[model samples]
Target: MTVTAPEMANGIFGGVFNLNYSGDKNRLIWHRHWLVCISCGAYAGVGCFLFAPRGLMYGFVASLFTSCCSIWADYVHIEDPQHLAHLVDRWAAFHFFFVLVCECAYVLHMPIWYLTMTLCLALALFSLSRSSRSRQSWVLLHSAWHVLPMGLLLLPGLIS
Candidate 1:
């Protein structure tokens, strides 16, 4: 079953799009991280197209398309919190698929680095206790999630 916004809070414990931040200072930091993640994601998408092999290119292209949609959803929902849950659910599903594709494509060439990166990603994702409690950590960790997979493109055998 697909989870929605309200249900997402139950799963993530108010992480991701929690707007009840401490103050403008922290919120500003969060916004900066958001921009960083978006920039990294866009860069990764383009890099994947340019660097990935021909057969695997389609997966990255599809991921890039969905990620573009995710970017728009993120910007729009930030302005209006009512749609946040649905957008998160959609993007989260796509992200999982993207991860699977990355795993399949990259693991073929570099197993050790892939394992290490996956471990880091698991740490970042699983450590999200609450966004309210640690907004900086939440944003930073999730940003790592967006950033780490791109490193696969730099792996020796994978880059082409």
Candidate 2:
């Protein structure tokens, strides 16, 4: 059965939530990686109560971006935390491309709020490249990195 947010409402640790995920952040494998993302998409596509003709596009680009970043990291090395260091190396690239897709998807529609949030998310992403020393800071920013895009794509009230 397709999982729903309500079913896992207790949290990620809920029993029903472990369909096929590794649950390891340091190294998120395919099953978990895809489960989390596809679940995210399912939520956005269903729960958002918005017109999401572009949702699949956003999801496709997201997956592609991650794959590309994974390759880039394996081949290259960088020390910078807030720059190409992530794409040249880690998860930051994942967030960047996600925001990139989110940003581009709006070029045609460009609603007032969408444009505003788009800029906000873009700024948040750019700031991610600046690097942070505080682990808490990174945590907050990283969570926002994922939550904001999902919110933009899914939480909007009646997007069309």
Instruction: Report every candidate's CA lDDT.
Output: 0.48, 0.41
Compose the digit string of candidate 1's lDDT tens values, residues 102-157: 65557444465665766556444534422334656656655555555545444444
Candidate 1 segments whose C-alpha is farther than 4 A from its true place: 1-34, 37-53, 84-99, 102-123, 126-135, 156-160
lDDT of 2 by residue, 11-31 (tens): 432221222322233232112
User: What residue pairs clash in candidate 2, if any at all?
Assistant: 21-32, 82-129
Total colliding residue pairs, candidate 1: 1
Model 2: residues >4 Å from true position, as ranges?
A: 1-59, 62-64, 67-85, 88-113, 125-131, 157-160
Best by lDDT: 1
TM-score of each: 0.52, 0.38
lDDT of 2 at 83: 36
